[model samples]
Target: MSELKEQLKSQIIEQLNLEDLTPADIKNDSPLFGDEGLGLDSIDALEFIVLLDSFYGIKIEDPAAAREIFHSVDSMADFIESKK
Candidate 1:
């Protein structure tokens, strides 16, 4: 799970073009969006969907669930493990 979280941080930075942030800068429990977090917008949400499919071979069919699944690196990791 820790490895997945670390990998997610790196992938999110590269996928979202967050050049200012390093993997260490993103906390596993930190929110991935909104004003208090990474501040990612709607379009970034689309990129996140793509990132999941391309990197992890995971597909999110339900948009509503994405809100919970993509909440943080920890949640993403948990979701991935659940699928396995």
Candidate 2:
């Protein structure tokens, strides 16, 4: 689980092109899509959807659903683990 979180953080930083952040900078439970956290926007959300499909082979077709499931690193890990 810890390894998965670390991997997810690395992937998120890379896929989202977050040049300012390292994996250690992102808390597991931190909100990932708002001004308060990483300040990611809709495009980043889409990129995350792509990341899920490409990296985890989890297909998420709905943006609204993706928003809820990919709310944070912990939530994303939970969703991926559930799928697995």
Candidate 3:
């Protein structure tokens, strides 16, 4: 689980081109979107969807559903775990 979290963190930073953030900077339960969190927008959300499919082989077609599941790193991990 820790390995997955670390890999996800690194992937997120790399995929999103967040040059300023290290994996240690992100909390496991931190919100990934909105002003209260990473400030990610709709584009980031789309990227996350792509990330899911590309990295995890999880295909999420509905934008609304994706929004709910991809709300935070923890949530995304949970979703991925459920899928597995």
| Clash count per candidate | 0, 0, 0
lDDT score for candidate 2 against the true structure: 0.91
lDDT of each: 0.86, 0.91, 0.88
Q: Which wins on lDDT, candidate 1 or candidate 2?
A: 2
Q: Looking at model 3, which ten-residue stretch has the lowest summed lDDT?
A: 63-72
Flag regions of model 1 displaced more than 4 Å. none
Residue 2, candidate 2: Cα error in Å is 1.1
Q: TM-score for every candidate vs. truth? A: 0.92, 0.95, 0.93
**Which stretches of candidate 2 lie above 4 Å from their native place?**
none
lDDT of 1 by residue, 9-52 (tens): 89999999988899998888888889867887677888889999
Report the lDDT tens digits of candidate 3 across residue range 1-84. Answer: 778888898999989999899999888888888897788989998889888899999998887778878787788888899999
Model 2 lDDT, residue 37, Cα? 86
Give the per-residue lDDT of model 2 (tens digit) for 16-84: 888788999999998988897899889898999899999999988888778888789999999999999
